[model samples]
Target chain A: MGITSGRGRLRTVSATAAVLALSGTGLVAYGLSKQDTATPPSPGRSTAAAESPSGAASSPPPARKGAAYAVPQGDVLDRSQPTRVRIPSLKVDTDVIDLGLQPNRRMEVPQNGKQAGWFTGSPTPGQLGPSIVAAHVTWQSKRGVFFELGAMKPGQRIEVDRQDGTTAAFQVDQVGQYPKASFPTEKVYGTVDRAELRLITCGGVYDGDSGHHLDNIVVFAHLVPSTAPHAHHTG
Target chain B: MRTTTKLALAAPAACAMIFAGASGAHADDGTYTMKLTDTMGNNSGSHSTATVHVMGDQLKVHITGSGFTPNSPHAQHFHGSFSENKNFTCPTSAADTNGDGQVSTEEGLPMYGDIMISLTTKGDTSPKSGLAVDRMPVADAQGNLSYDRTITLPAGAGAKLKNLHIVQHGLDANGNDKYDLDALGESTFAKSLGVSGIPQEATNPATCGTVSGASVGAEPTGGVDTGDGTTQGVEDVGILGLGALTLAGAGGAWAYRRRLGRQS
Candidate 1:
């Protein structure tokens, strides 16, 4: 009888010890998670983790931890221009380039390697003002970013990251397809507090003779948080 | 076999409850398949799939189609689904929540946007064109698109496409259409985009679990992308599950017996 009782006590102790170890391990794991989230990050991180209460955000763009916005002072120089965008919902991943007016006042294609340019005049994405990035529907023998712009819709995500480690996450508000002759550059690229981002591509009347789309597809998105600027870099 | 049985049994109740439920027949994801037809020409142009991805009340759409006339411009639209006894395309979600049911509009109720998808002509031509999504009005049961944008077609389109269906819609598979947040403030990806926030009726067919077979010749990259563009990495997932149901969890006692001495 004593032996049996002793065995039963051992089983109970084992179970208790297991529970204690698991709980301790769980606490440590949770602590690590907290540490990992101590500092907010750029939107491009694309991580899946538990959210911390109050969503500790970093600088300029005021989206939660994952998508931090930017504040551009002057023409902040960097190695690479933040061109090209990706939107999962739109299933678009394309390069961006500024489309200076052609002789006919149409957008131009980038001459170099997969480069998408931002309109120098506009506020870059992740910063104040509207960020305008344009790319060719087809350049040379190939197509460029925003090539499939017309296919995008609202509620999709558009991400533009700069070399300075700041990224702007643009949540599409509208996608408009208009004639290239009436590109509506002014309305599409208007300045606003919302950290708006617009993706422009050619569509509309496809002139088989000219071999280019006649109209433009414009996607509009606002900053995830336009009212609140983040505290900037965390850690 | 199991799913077939479940589907068959649920079909009747689901059909009955659909009308009894939401005033409007809406999909949680609001994704759809669009087939463009020129009633005037008596021709069917093309059919494509679109998912109006919603993020935090924001709606966006993603579209994919094969056999498209590259470089052609075609108008796009969202039309009302067919009413009962109306001769219309099959698989209209608004009228039939279950594939087995149908209802008519003359009964004083019209399903909104029974037909979804605006026409887009495909062909190569200089000078692009397309329409703003919001500008396009929601469709009523008459199969009419917003603004009667239906009168004409864009120039230069010729092709045949098949298998038009909304690939993936809704939030976290079986979860809510909005982002799922615990008291801890953790946000589910589904929540960041409002697709997860939609009501129960808007979900896509049960078979679409984020990973369905794609057509041949696709790059087969074998990695699922994380939405952010700057990240050049891909996560390898032989099984791309947005989230799948785990039916075995309810059997706690049996699970414990197999754990051999493992304690939670």
Candidate 2:
């Protein structure tokens, strides 16, 4: 699917939802209809819904910040879809699942505890913005896929194997844990000029009553320069 | 045996028992062990145990667990005594009233008493005790978490720990991440959050067990004990020797600089 065409469809979908006074549920229902077949709407075309800062991170602005490291110069991946992730340091070898937005506008967590999930609403793992992947810290008293995510030190590498015959490599830069109450929405979902990878999971104090983690552990990494050549940038 | 002879034997035994009780539920210098087992209806295939050492008002707790969610944090707490007409024991499959295939934390509450102390992560203590389920430190990469902490529990709470249940909560598969009635189907999460009046399947108690006195001088499995004083001394000496080496190297360098200046 063409990125330009996908953006056009998203604009149309958003307009229709607004005119119909769709609830969050209706909006998600519409979102899913358009999500699978098209690439995520690009940051270049500013949608009014995305411009709003009030909602669950509304929309991310265009990539205004320069990359901290040198990005691949040639064709980036065409959002070809990542199928699995392997982190040798973490001894993590798991399948990557697809996720979409919930009625709350937050990305749906991977339903399965064992699998890592990619946000279908964001760019694919090798895309130009922060491609989000998340899993539970623990599931049903069992540890989820990204359980040891916080222990990831800088310089460690994460590999995402895509449907295309290529693998996207990301080198860790920072791994920080923040309370869920003060989650850095802008920093995580904001637009960046290069392909970035974010692995997120619950951490901090576990509230037994609520059965949820109070904090979120985030691992930030950028695409390795060499892996960029293998990416087919449809954008 | 003669009555007088039997009384002589019984009196000393009774006196000794009284003296032990007067000392405290647990000796200040003694250690207690808590063996954890999977709770009723929740099968996670994890084994865990905790050892508590009471030193004055401070309680040192050492917890070791394996077969848990790899690198994840499991919310834990010491529930109130089972002596208050409550079972205070981990629930069983029969406790699955609604037939949800699993016994939730709320469903098992009648068996385990009120939460006495919440073993939370860094920075938070009582009052916000139960608030820690989500913010605690996580397990390591191997689905194992070994934690040790020294904290003061509520007054009299530590004394009753031997009769209390240590409960660990379960996870939400939907990833709504919060205890919501919509995703969890009107469970304890709703009651804790006050969204629902009645608790549905709130918190899921994955594993649970109780604390009991470990024999004095018995080989302690896990606790603040160093196993042997000699081993600890050796470690201290090693650290001190490293420090001494660094100081000697600096002194040697300084002496060489002075000699070089004199020759020049």
Residue range A69-97, candidate 1, lDDT tens digits = 11122222222346556666646665665
DockQ values of all predictions:
0.01, 0.01
Tens-digit lDDT string for candidate 1 (B10-97): 1221100111111121112112123221111101222233333322223344444332222222233333322233322222212222
lDDT of 2 at A17: 57
| Residue-level lDDT tens digits of model 2 in B84-157 | 63545665544656645466776777777767677776656553466355565465667676778888765655
TM-score of chain B of 1: 0.22
The stretch of ten residues in a row with the least summed lDDT in candidate 2 chain A is: A63-72
Correct interface contacts retained, every candidate:
0.00, 0.00
Model 2: docking quality category: incorrect
True contacts kept of 2: 0.00
Runs of candidate 1 with Cα error greater than 4 angstroms are: A1-84, A90-107, A112-114, A140-143, A209-211, A225-235, B1-264
